[model samples]
Target: MSKLQEVFKNKSGNVLNVYCTAGYPHLESTLQIIDTLQKNGADIIELGMPYSDPLADGPVIQQSSLVALENGMTIATLFSQLKNLPSSTGDKEAAIILMGYMNPVLQYGFEKFCKDAAEVGVSGLILPDLPEYEYETEYGAIIKKCGLDFIFLVTPETSEERVRRLDLLSSGFLYAVSSSSTTGNEKDFNAVEKYLERLKSLNLKNPILVGFGIKDKETFNTACKYANGAIIGTAYIKALEGAANVEQATKKFLAGILK
Candidate 1:
């Protein structure tokens, strides 16, 4: 089983998966944020690669990405920042997943990106814009050969047949988009519940992690009750913007998850 699948097995027992954009708010803050999330009980961490044109991101994440890029965050710089993570995370074994568009990966070179990501401890990737057909036809085998789990995202609009196909293709967990929109939009619990029910009934091989608009404890609780875990982003970034230190910000942001 992939490390991500193993992490989900444990989280299925009881845990939350948290996602945060790398190099957001600042460059070095990425390392500190990952360390903080793991120390504070984030089961799985999604480190987003800041991109120039983030079509799927809401204003909060889009603006944060802009600021991150302005601070000179790039794939190479991100890899450099990640070199400090193993020591920083201490004994935590949280599965680290890189979330981004394909453009940056192409620019960084696919083989190099996969190889270096594995070396840096990234077990999986979430690319929103990469279609399933294209992935299967082209990049799927290469990513699998590199030992990377190419996580698939399914929205409210995704069909059951597609879900089954994705379940078969996905090596780790399925990222269930909470609603039919970008991050920071209000999560439609009704839509999320229906999707969760469908996914559970399908009995796919992998577990599911709900993302987008999972801002606080209530939403997190709702997601975990229906799915394996919840992935939070925009709200956490907003908290970091008002924080004195990244650690403090992470502490405060996670405090809500527990409360």
Candidate 2:
């Protein structure tokens, strides 16, 4: 089984997937961040590839991406760093999923991107702008050939038919956007609860992980109520914003959520 599949197999719920921008805070910080998150409490590391234009991200993530790009973070640099990185933290292996826009990846060459990602122990990908049709016809085959999962996102506005279609296309897990907005925005748990209820009732093939606005213990608990887990990005970034020690900040931030 894939590392992501193993995570679900071992833990039926409360899977904590954390997102971190590559090269954020400093150019040499990517690997350190990955190690810190995995060693602390994150079950999955959704590493964001800095892009000039990231429409799906919020201001916090956007700013991080800008800093990462300014720090000279690139797909090649990230691959080089991940090459020496271990996949497992002792017995449990944390799944690594790259989150980014399609433009930068296409520039890096789609085939080469998948090949390098697989070689570097990447478990999956999340490219929000990749259309379903293009994926099924072109990119999806490349990803599958490299033995990597591709996750799809669905929002509250998505029709049941569309949600099921996305769920069918997704692997590892389906990322359910808590609301129909960009990342880091506030969420209405009442509406989110009802929406998650609908998703639960659909019985999707892959497990569900709610993203966007899941910032702390209370929100994480609420998100995990009906889904397998939740994804936290902005909050974690905020924790690391001005911290003197990234690892310590990561440990404390994760402890607050999973505590």
Candidate 3:
């Protein structure tokens, strides 16, 4: 099993996943932010690849992505940044997952990108635009060869058959988008609950990590009640912007979720 799978399995329920844009605020800040989140009890880290066009993202993430790109963040640069991560210490070993779209991977060459990501300790890749069929046909074998877990997202609109297919092929946990729209958009809890019920009815083998619009303790608790874990993105970034230090911001964010 991949490190991501192991981590989620160990944590079981109420896992806190954090997302950040690579090279945002500053290039060197990428590792620092991730390290901070880890120290503050983020179970899994979703490091945004900083693509030029993040279609599935809301304004907050889109703005962060643009800033990261302006700071010269690219696939190669992100790998380079990962290579410079600090040595592991204490009980703070967090799995890193690269989240982005497909164009950047194609631009970087799929095989080379996978190889580089593995070399730099990324546990997996989350491609929002990668259809299950296309991945199975083209890059699935290559991704497996590199020992990288490729995650797929399931939305309310996802069919029962598609959910099963995605679950069977998924190595890491499946990302469950809370709503049909982009990340960070708010929707009814009833809708989210219904979606969870639908996913449960499918009896998927892989664990699920809920994402989008999960900003505080209430939402996190809601997600934990059904899914294996919950991911917070825009809220964490908002915290990052408010605090003087990344560590301080991470602590505040984590405290809110854990409370």
Task: Please provide, for model 2 over 114-217, each residue's C-alpha lDDT reduced to its tens digit, 9 standing for 90 to 100.
Answer: 99999999989999999999999999999999999999999999999999999998889999999998999995777789999999999999999999999999
Better of 1 and 2 by lDDT: 2
Off by over 4 Å in 3: none
Ranked by TM-score, the better of candidates 2 and 3 is 2
Q: What is candidate 1's CA lDDT for residue 251?
A: 86
- In order of lDDT, best first, we have 2, 3, 1
TM-score for all models, in order of appearance? 0.95, 0.98, 0.96
> What's model 2's lDDT at 183?
91
- List where candidate 2 sits over 4 angstroms from the true fold: 87-91
RMSD of each: 1.5, 1.0, 1.3
lDDT of 3 by residue, 1-259 (tens): 7789889778888888899988876767888788878887888899998887889999888988988898888889888888988768775778999999899999899999999999999999999898877888999999999999988898889888888888888878888998888987888866788788778667688888899889899988989888988999998877776466766767777888886
Worst 10 residues of 1 by lDDT: 84-93
Write down the lDDT of every candidate, Cα atoms only.
0.83, 0.92, 0.86
Give the deviation of candidate 2 from the true structure as CA RMSD: 1.0
Residues 1-259 of candidate 1 have per-residue lDDT tens digits of 6678778765573467776777777778887777788878788888889999999999999898888899899989988888777653356667888999999999898888888998887899888888888898888877888899988988889999988888788878888888889899995576678777777788888788888888888888888777877788888888888578889879878887875
